[model samples]
Target: MALNSGNGTVPDSKLGDEHVAVQKLQPDAKIYDRLMTLSGFFKQQYGDEPEFYVRVPGRVNIIGEHVDYCGYSVLPMAVEQSIILAVGTNKQRAQLELHHLDEGKFQSFDCDLSDLEIKLPKTGGPGWYSYFLCGIKGIQEELNDKWRPIGMRIALSGNVPLAAGLSSSSALVSAAVLATGHAQGMPLDRKQLASISASCEQYIGTHSGGMDQAIAYLAKQGCAQHIEFHPKLKGTPVTLPAGSCFVVANSLVQKRKAASSDYNERVVECRLATRWLAKSQKLPNWKDLIRFVDLQEACHLDNDAYVKLIDQQLKKSIYTREDICEGLGITEQELETDFLTPSTQHMQQFKLRQRALHVIQEAGRVVKFRQICEQLQRRSSKQDIEQLGQLMQESHHSLRELYECSHPDLERLVALSAKQGVSARVTGAGWGGCIVAMCDSVKAASDYVNVLKREYYAQLPAHLLERYQPNDFNEVVFATFPSNGAELFVQ
Candidate 1:
């Protein structure tokens, strides 16, 4: 199953373009064969050669969780995993077919540019398929008459974890939009593609702030982008300092909110909070409240004159818990059971605090981290990797304490990395998912893995240990920067 032939081998040309030199997260021979077979079928069915391979990556939020929806900047990067779509175009009808590699199923929908009601099946469950369709639909809606309905066959394959806060759904939607745009011969650039996908994927019910799709679509190899979404979609890729290695560890605990059950409700709550805050301040929109301030202006919230002004504005629109619950369409009991606390009440309250604090602090850290990285990129004198490390440590603490995304396994992993002299934090949405650690050196990472294999494996849940026995230090991964976004393939 050579779906991605250059697995684990970095391409020399992947430095600065829409080319990703990443390892296939789950390179299955059978799945790859199924996907390629579908590609062949499309070629045979539509009489068009398979174009280039396009892979949109699944992202990891390094320091920010649930903050993007608050209209704040986020530190996230497209990981070395992606949803690979092998696509080709047809001149005949306006339709798109998705060939599922895992289930050996083919699901598709004919494109009706005028009819937005046509729905596609969500692969993971209900409304999932429609999200994928919505990306295409959004693009079609934008193109109007210039874009014709072109047929396409997309063979999906990837290793990005689903429902673990890794943006798997967003990747799928973005990949589909990319493939469909290419098939239709539209002039949709990377940013436009990302914006379209984000807007449509939002229809799937999560009021996401467009970070995942932006990183997935505009990602570059060897660089982590610092993205600000408020005033405009502006980003600059910050290069990593030499001798730095990143370790991403999956905690293997899946939370219920990630799937179709209760995740959408939390999004609603955040939106309600913003709207309430906006009205209290008498602002037209919540985006008006988002202000980019200097380091001095941001230090104190209560005493500082500027902070007082902002606080006064927010305090006016502060809603009671009941009001928030009603706006989000949930009862207090439902909120207590489903929204407020997924783990425990104590844990949930702690998480709400953590989430609020992380957004404020992390929005500040992004500027500092980028400045430090930029300084290192130019002059070798006075490198502040320690500052970056300290910020990462603080960010992780806020994530663990205030944001409440960190699980015990993630905490253990971070602690292990710290013992080995590495700085680490929970990546993505946390609460039993992956953690990204910045190792002092590759040797330090290796040492951490060796220690973790001895200590962490035995502590796993009995069910997981029995079904998937821990291999001492076996699944730990180390990677660097300069990854690509999606590309087209023709064969």
Candidate 2:
């Protein structure tokens, strides 16, 4: 059976019963050559042609940051960069053979599909294959009744930068899940796969909200999606301004979310602050509340009212562990086990006021950002466009100050972007990642790229600088628009 194709749905076409249809890449497409290369490599490695391939694209958040898990909407678009997998199933064996295009960087691994174990590192992050395993396990869990372990030889190739906050890891996991599902001939839907991908990623130990996976499956070409999570997982396509373009520039500093507690620590703080605010409002079962959005709904307040509530309830800028336990009437052990994530269970002070303030205010910004984009679609003008840019600037400031997720390199990139009159902010979970900057036109984007090359890339270490060519620096910085969502092809 063929998958449903909707306006914002993933483009997944299933093979016919005869399995004779062959999916071919468009000759003029940018990734056509790369796909052909991977197909050749798969033939050499597995000694046969692959059955099908999967493509999942990485995304760059335009404005929203660190507020998705708080149950707020985010505006993001999928980039041209993506992860591609070439697969061939072996019905006789129960093992999975995984290979990467870059053999030296990623070693090949074979594992039994029936018993998959994802081992988190004692320190730092899990191995690369752990992400793949997360996807496989997700599909297996979804198909529990009809699941049968099948052997598969897969070859992976990708251009998305690793750990630069561009959603590369999530894209890989999404691809793996799609590949596994297609190989098993199980029916798949975009929404269901997105939900599964988000939940299954926790196996690698990052408390992510579902933004990356949602966009990876629901994105459409030439449009940015306003994805809301509180009410439901739905994406509304927002047409960008006529002349404006978005440029992504990496800070070259990698932040692996699973390797450190910084990302989860923020998550813990937000949850604690939510409960604290809920109690202040005398809401029933306040202790059960974990997301700020839920508290807002229970209080029957708008975003502005919620911002005031943050100031009224969470008075103290910082709350110690003792203070939190006392306020909630819970023991420290309960707080550790129930409230905090395992990675952030250590003794520490929580910045309830700043974190909550950032979340509430950032949530408002997402609304305003979407509103401005909608307005621009109706009437595009210089002043209206500047208003959107100004909102992006405010977002970066809040992320840098209140959220404390921005890295020095990110701040520098933002500062440099300002010099070029571009509005930019840290895109993903921050702390060293790419910044998405909005420029007026293609020429304006070209000028901004040149400025960054001269001011920022020139200052890098000699070794790093030598690896990048002056003429071809598109990998580090490039202008992008929305692209199609995840796709599956049978050959």
lDDT of every predicted structure (CA atoms): 0.61, 0.86
Question: Where is model 1 more than 4 Å wrong at Cα?
Answer: 1-49, 104-128, 255-356, 379-383, 457-480
Query: Against the true structure, whose TM-score is highest?
Result: 2
lDDT of 2 by residue, 1-491 (tens): 44433332223245421121224445555566777899999999988998887889999999888888889999999998999999999899889999999999999988988778888879878888899999999888888878887888999999998899999999999999888887887666777888889989888888888999989988888999999997888889999888888999999999999898999999989999999998988888998899989988888989889888888878887899999999988999999888987788784899999999898888888888888889887876788889899989999899889989998999899999988788999999999989999998999999999999889988888777777765466688889989877877654
Compared to the true structure, candidate 1 yields what TM-score? 0.74
- Candidate 2: which pairs clash? none
Question: How far off is residue 442 in model 1, in Å?
Answer: 1.8
User: Which tens-of-lDDT digit does each residue in 1-491 have in candidate 1?
Assistant: 33343432223344334333333433343234534665676565556665656677888766555556565667677777778777765577555666555544335444443355644334344344565676777777777778775666655566676656677778888887877776667754677787788787545545557888888877766778887776567667877777777767667766523244234443444434444344444444333333323222333332244334434433423345665555445677865665443323322211222233445566667667778888987865334988888888988887676555577778887887788777888776667767777776778767765566567765677876774454442443445344566654433
Worst 10 residues of 1 by lDDT: 343-352
Window of ten residues with lowest summed lDDT in model 2: 15-24
